[model samples]
Target: MLSVLTLNVQAAALPRARRLLAWLDARDDNLIILTETSNGPGTAYLLEQCRAAGLDVTHTPSPDGDRGCAIVSRLPTTARPDLLAGVTLPGRAVAVTVNTESAITVLGLYVPSSDRAPAKVAKKRAFLTSVIDGLRGLTEGQRAHLIVGGDYNVISRNHRPRYPGFLSFEYEFLDALEQLDLADAHQRLHPTTQAHSWIGRGGNGYRFDYLHTGAALTPHLASCDYLHQPRDRQLSDHAAVAATLRLTVDHRTAVSAPLAEAAALS
Candidate 1:
């Protein structure tokens, strides 16, 4: 089974992001995704922390700072930018392919929340389109398993009423998601989890972070949930979302199971 934990640690400063590390430390997942880390803290620090907590880690930074993304894991994975599709956006999402004996590929994506401006909004929309197109290559029960996790910065109507500018933007994002036949693991698997990642300057909080996988991934979907226990109004204001996927043991399951059953019959 391959389980992945994804979080946007706001800034990777130790004191500021210690809870983020602690939260990850508790989970024994196969993979971990951390987005929005500051360049000052660097990928080395996050990798070191993951090693201390006993996970093999690797990270790829976006050409732009703060747009950097990282992937840490107990599972053996090779990080590559070639696997990602180009959207001409400021930041980039790291595509980490876990070379399991299963031959499965899991791409981790972090889409940014462009602020309110015509240009920025247009960029966000274009980026979303590219991401969907990039991931559309996957075919069910075969090829690769695409698991995209990131701070989308769009709030869902199911969680809270639409924020002022979010009305059109959020709908567009969701529509793009549906168009690609991908499922938001949080909403589909666990709807009760609190809206996480942002406490707006306005009165309400937001659930901008997500773990989205194609319907082809349904079999491996184990469980999904959020940690909203201690709502820190000041300390970065984004809660973490975690997901567990019970992956098969590649072809070994199908091949060995039948043989084993045959042996039992004999």
Candidate 2:
């Protein structure tokens, strides 16, 4: 069993930040991600906090907005070309390969919000399209286990938005995920125990965080949850989403055969 957690930590108060870090410390979640990270000082501060706690931080920012995204992973991670190339998206973006007890690859992501201005919105679309294309190169996690996670911002049938009017964006997003054939990680589990990552200040709430997986990975999903119980007033207006999955493959099977084969031939 391997666990991954995603949150938009709001980057507000030191106390609130500490609370999040403390929560992570308590859990055995192999990977942690935060979206809408404060660009400079606050990001550095949070990075330090994670570092002191023994998490290695990898950060990235968008060209159009003050907000950014970060990956805090305990498991060994290597940069993926899709994320390392640094495509021209508006907000912060990050992608990493998490080597866990069960799986070798987990995509650590933070996509741009569609709520930003017109140009930023356009940039967000570009980012989404790029991600879709990048996902195509990935091997389906049937005999293998792979995961794509982050603040997806748009939810599909597996999830929905807090505000009803926000469905327009979600509709498009659902279509995209459907087109990609990515299954909602939470749906395979008991829906009653399911939770999402958002709590509306207006009292509206929705499940916006996600773990998109392929058909083979769909069944391995054992549990999904949204940690909505707030420690403070508003922690970046988004809660954390966590999951546990029972993978079918052993760690040895997860090794990249292509790379190994190439080395053998050489």
Candidate 3:
């Protein structure tokens, strides 16, 4: 069984980072994807713990250093490619291919919220389009086990900005994932349940985090859902999403330096 967890750790909150490491140490999740890491000493310490726990780690730092994404795996991981084809805000996304009993391409993303100026909105749209195009290209040629999960900053529906989320374009961009045959694992397993990962002011909630898997991986999906304990406990504002799959391969492969810098941390 391969367990994968994705979370936005909320800007390197030290206490939460420690708690996250401790929780991860207790589990056997093969892959963990984190966003909004903030490139701080706390995250560095957590990386140390992941290394001690025998997990390979790779990270993409945002230019400003306030946010970033990381991929940690117990199995070997090689850098895949950034989903963006053009210029994009750094540290918001990272991709890696994990080779174990089976090879799975995983992407951790933190899509920008479009509640900003026109330029920022354009950038966000472009980033979303680039990711879609990248996945489309992957599916058109070599089909690999693919899973992309993280804070999308968009909801499942296209309702007006009633609370806090994108309205139209973002919703359509997300719908493209489904068009490409990627199933929203959480929704697939828990159809009709209005589970929210992020709570807003006045007790409103939004399901901004998600895990979308390729069609080929659907059958192997043992489970996919949110872990709200940390969020409820105030360890982090976003709930961690977890997915489990049964794979049957076991080997390592080399990856490009740009995809992965350091060797698996021991």
Against the unseen true structure, what C-alpha lDDT does each candidate score? 0.61, 0.61, 0.73
The regions of model 2 sitting more than 4 angstroms off are: 61-65, 83-86, 101-103, 139-144, 157-170, 191-196, 231-233, 247-266
Where's the lowest-lDDT run of ten residues in candidate 2? 255-264
Better of 2 and 3 by TM-score: 3
TM-score (all chains, Cα) for each model? 0.78, 0.76, 0.86
Clash-forming residue pairs, model 1: 102-250, 197-238, 197-239
Q: List, residue by residue over 1-266, the lDDT tens digit for candidate 2.
A: 66667777766566566555555566646667777687555566667766555455677555444676677776567755454353555345676666554445556556666655678677667766666656665555521455667777776554444355453554576576655666667755655554656756676566667776656566767777777654244546777778877753334423222222222233
Report the lDDT tens digits of candidate 1 across residue range 121-212: 77777777776666555554433356777777776656665566665655677666765666788778766656555666675777777787
Off by over 4 Å in 1: 51-54, 137-144, 157-159, 167-169, 191-197, 229-236, 248-266
Scanning candidate 3 in windows of ten residues, the lowest lDDT window is: 254-263
lDDT of predicted model 2:
0.61
Q: Score candidate 1 by lDDT.
A: 0.61
Pairs in clash, predicted candidate 3? 101-249, 101-250
User: For candidate 3, lDDT tens digit of each residue in 209-252?
Assistant: 88888877877888988889868777689898999887764534
Residue pairs that clash (backbone atoms under 3 angstroms), model 2: 62-91
